[model samples]
Target: MNRRLYRGLREAILEGAIAADTRLPASRDLAAELGIARNTVVHVYSQLLAEGYTRSRQGNGTFVNASLPDSFLSSGRRARLAAAPQPRPALSPRGAAIVDGASASPYQWGAFMPGVPDLTEFPHRKFGRIVSALWRNPPPDLLTYAHGGGLPALREALAQHLALTRSIDCDPEQIIITEGSHQAIDLASRILGDPGEVAWVEDPGYWGARTVLQANGLRIRHLPVDEEGMQVPQEAGGEPPRFIFVTPSHQYPLGPVMSLARRRQLLAVARRHGSWIIEDDYDSEFRFSGRPIASLLGLEPDAPVIYMGTFSKTLYPGLRVGYLVLPRPLVAAFQAAHAELYREGHQMTHAALAAFIADGHYAAHIRRMRMLYGRRRAMLVNLIERRLGADWLHRDASLAGLHLVLTLPPDMDDLRVVEEARARGVLTRPLSRYYADPALRRPGLLLGFACVPEQDIARKFEVLLDSLAEVARKPARAARA
Candidate 1:
């Protein structure tokens, strides 16, 4: 009788039909209900308590343990062990790299994130019309593999757009439509550097590029970024890296436009070193300040530069459209690489996006979003000033991109602040997470304001303020003691 009662309760608890913290029925009442002896129920409860399945609260009744070990609580795991062969960790050189980092909780607060477009303002109707138009009258050539260079019309349109807007003089033949800027980077890495070779990456730069380069097994030399963009080293180091990836247009998370002189110097350095200058013109399209800065590619048209840009930031991520304006010399090589990598052309999407650009709609959309985003950026600055008063961080914040960085107090760890902020229902990231080394860590939060609704900015800021106060108060009170 005792064994039967034990099995029933164990099964219920293990299957989670009876949840943790659920109180068991009274021993005498439960025995009668189950048609068992009262002594049987008592004995079962005692065994459960001893085995940590249940706990007694002295005078109160027995309850399921708030915490249970896996062996006793998970029936599926036990069943799996009984039936199939148990899996073992992989034995490899980079086995540890296969493990994933901790995932962020969704309910966390204060996520001043970056690289997100305002979905609320996405031109769905305009995009929908273009996509539908393409499907209605499909191009037969598009049904087969697209030309390695990409959709001819799209390449020509992109060339014209770059020439007029960015002063980048390029023949459509030299332009290769890529999946995204990341693919372009990967291609450049393969063409220029052998595995285990070196590449210069900006310090406290975009970790996305860092991860990609490292995954390819290339050694990375971290260079510091100043206000004038990636400061060209006074002397090009020996056996200089074959590739140097730079985001000269509003440096990621740092928002510093590269100076014209520095641009020339960078080109000179790359040319002299025989190194490839990988230019990521990611978000230069939406400039609120003065005249748009001509790309480094424009500075030396004949020089070796692998120009890459993405519509992900400008348009939307799901569109998956980006292009590379390669040097005339490397275009054929890249085409061969493209042929090996991509079999089916992304022709339908290419046609739709190309048609959208040709109709003067794409230009208009960029202009409209530029103005709207500028207003939102201004509103954010105003909100911060009005609410925070003099107690704000990063006063000289740049007015570009969908997000900005707010430098934290020198002693206060931004990582700890991010964790505490998450506890209070706000999602945010620390600048340190982006850095390659702890020594290069900047104590600050990377706040992305683009995706977040403008109306909710005040409420979110208030929550952020409250969290900051909590973090600050603890140290202050402790210091006084």
Candidate 2:
């Protein structure tokens, strides 16, 4: 066997030049092309087969093996790719395209990330107690197929909770428990709007909602959010959007509650335009700063708001318990959608959660976490002030959510800064990564402080500062270049 030919062909397949399962040219044909003897080609093929790099069929010729040697896969390919240049993701003809971009490094120093609740103090004992109780007396309905609308007990409890907490007027029958608020959005996209119809989303929004809307083939209009929450533009180009998704309780990523005036204005816009609103009250329970703003859905009881809430943020992400309180008209459609999918809530898990909430334990746990997180949040902000100084950066920070936004210096490359910090074992999200238009890429960091303790914040921020400093020192064109 000609070692050179064998190795070269092996490298080509392993390097993805000749993709997996692609049929290789017959030995005679390949030899003729390479200007080599048929015997040399045959010998090369034989060796490749022996080494499991190619599979040869009796009559049909050879195919590139899906699996290949690591040495073959790594040989000069990555280096060549590193040198090759590529364009940004092409915009999809449909609408605001999700450009294939790199996410912030998973490691962060004092990560000011949003939506992540603290896992350390999750009242595991109480949850276990509820689980034990549920196991002892499981609901008979648990064994039956779900009729699209979820567990009756959970629905009733959620309706009661909403009425009591958010002042939302809704019956258990009008509610449907979804996998999470994410699925609720998906369901809303399906039932509320037709394909290619416009649906409004928050500008610096929840990416999950954006993703679901895009996946469902809805054209998304990015409405700007401010201190008063989503400023619903009266004239949305020409035709009105079918639906608008808003997080009025605490606008995700920004953490601003929708003021009463704006909530009324939004509802008015929805009513005037005959459009529906998906109210994602993702973490209303964890409001650390102000009095809980009443839900927009509650404000306009019979209005066109599809109120969505999730226990994922309040209790835990793993629980996957969330409910949508729909307008009376859309209830049938959502129920039909649920039935079509044969979607049933996890009976055992929901039963446990129901018990947990039913007992005063859930309230007690929230009370504990609120205090713990309040201290952590205060400590995080103080450390940021003491370490970074207030005047050095704009402190237009939000007081409610798990994380806060910090504006970076104009010259900084947020993506690169986050990457460098992550290399030093700190993770965070660059605000730019969330934007569709490159011009909207604000140079800033979103620090998630819920999961990490107070003692670790200073050390993490110190490492982050070092990474930022290193990035700052590098020539603008050189670091990323």
TM-score for each candidate, following the candidate numbering: 0.77, 0.76
Counted clashes in each candidate structure? 12, 12
Model 2 over residues 173-194: C-alpha lDDT tens digits? 8999888877888888887678
Q: What would the TM-score be for candidate 1 when compared with the true structure?
A: 0.77
Worst 10 residues of 2 by lDDT: 101-110
Model 2 CA deviation exceeding 4 Å by range: 1-113, 136-140, 391-396
Error of 1 at 271 (Å): 1.1
Collision count of model 2: 12
